[model samples]
Target: MASTHSTFKNALIAILATFPSILFYISFLHHHNNEDHSLWNWCNQHPFLLANVMFFLNVNVLFWFIALLQSSLHWMIGLYWMVIPVMLLHFYANHPMAQYNQLRSWIVTILTWIWSIRMLHSYLRRENWQLGVKQDWRYIDMSHQYGKNWWWISFFAIYISQQVLQMGICLPLHVVHSVDKPLNLLDFIATVICIAGVTIAFYADTQLRIFISKNQKLKQLGQPLVPILDKGLWCYSRHPNYFGEQMWWWGLALFGWNLGHSYIFIGAVLNSMCLGYVTMLVEENMVRENYRANAYNLYQKNTSMWIPWLIKSTSNDKGKKN
Candidate 1:
């Protein structure tokens, strides 16, 4: 059928376009290394490991593309959840440094895996995966915006772009795993910060989940939805979850910093900037559109946007005095 042929043609185009990007990324990784041994040379010596990593990337991309075709962009979240573990495992298997300090390596690997698992669990619970929910609101918004063209657009914009970002963001894992340095004072500080960030995010997400559940129950009983949460961590920062996320990366960057790998800090910088842009522009705009705009605007006036400690005077209170 003509339709079947057309679908195959689109898929082929996507695959072809993605191949060059993957190759470029591999080259980038190789060239970015400051070590004497090139990644290409290392790969040549470890052909099996190279093959496995390539297969993993290809399979992940193809899976995401298929999910896009099904109008299920939620799977992109899964791709992100898998990145840390996959990259960490790749380094563990191939890099000699991973075996240098078994305790330190285990500590890093276990912590990352725990965080990844927690994130995936939160996403699944929020999305109600058991009930077969297939997409998040952001992706749904994009689908509405793009209409018929969303299939390819989502593939490139959401899936492929995220894959690239994951590579950059997970750079710390690669560096840390491949370094023979023992855990130092900076590593301890980094660990404390990372753990604190994860704890904060965990609690913040719990509060959010509870709020959503209560709102859902109220709606079921024909009551109004609560527009804003201004208590607990929400009282300190408008986006504690996002702030925690940034802290987590910065902490990881500190680990690399302690190791004297300056370039590895790029992951934290880029991740923070990306989060800033998303939170300020995309997420806030969405909240203004979907929720009670006045309440959210008021919350924005009083609460710190990124820093939890810097609370401001509310516009409402100022107006009341006037």
Candidate 2:
């Protein structure tokens, strides 16, 4: 049947994507001891940094491969997502060759774990305890636009992009584990910021979910749905969750920044650029829904797009209130 063929294709695509990383890793392990002045020998000598980078990169590539086999991108919301951060923590605590830079590495690793776990928990709940049930709306739209090309395109556009973003944004994992900086006051600041970001994101996502569910119930009762979620975190920022996510990455970057690695900030900055695009897309999607367009525009006028601040009241908001 058609369904069977599709499943087989997805499986094939997943295998193809992951097999290269596995093969390369195996080859590296076999050749690591051959002191021939090549990158392999170099990696063997500096296994602490190189090995950690190689392992995390391979792990994330495998994630996208796993994602390819799923019915939708949602399936990537589990262990595949947590593996790098989790493994980073593990290596720091146990691996003999790891930098294990005292509380410096552990603090960043724990923050990464907390962020990943929080995201994993949120997505699991969002999917109603089941994943692979829904494709991201943008992914679906892209698939339709590209037609049959989407299969191959998905690998590059979605999977490959994820690998880049994950590795980039998680540069702290590489830096913290590779560098031997000690703990300092900056770490305390990083911890507070990281926790604050997570907490804010948690509240934002929870409030949005509640708002959505309430609207669904209203529709079920043949009542009008609430056109806007302007309460709590939403009242302060149009995309508090995005702001919080940015905070989390920048917080982790502080670990490297404190250790004199200013370039680590690039990952966080790139993440912000990507989030900016996503925010634009989400805002567009919101306004396209006729039921909420007017209310959302007014809400936009009353709030900052990313930063949480005092609500800006405009004449439109005042008139609406009257």
Q: In model 1, which range of ten residues has the least summed lDDT?
A: 313-322
The sequence of per-residue lDDT tens digits that candidate 1 reaches over residues 1-322 is 6555644554454345346435644664556454665764576455335544654466456656556565554444443444445544554444432433455556666667767776766776786533123455567788889999887777676756665566666666666655677777787888888888888888888898998899899989998777777667877887888888778878877766777788877767777877887786754674565555766766766678877864565334422110
Stretches of candidate 2 off by over 4 Å are: 1-74, 77-79, 88-97, 314-322
- Go through the candidates in order and give each one's C-alpha lDDT: 0.64, 0.71
- Top TM-score model: 2
Off by over 4 Å in 1: 1-60, 72-87, 93-99, 129-132, 281-291, 313-322
Give the Å error, residue 158, model 2: 0.9
Estimate the overall C-alpha local distance difference test score of candidate 2.
0.71
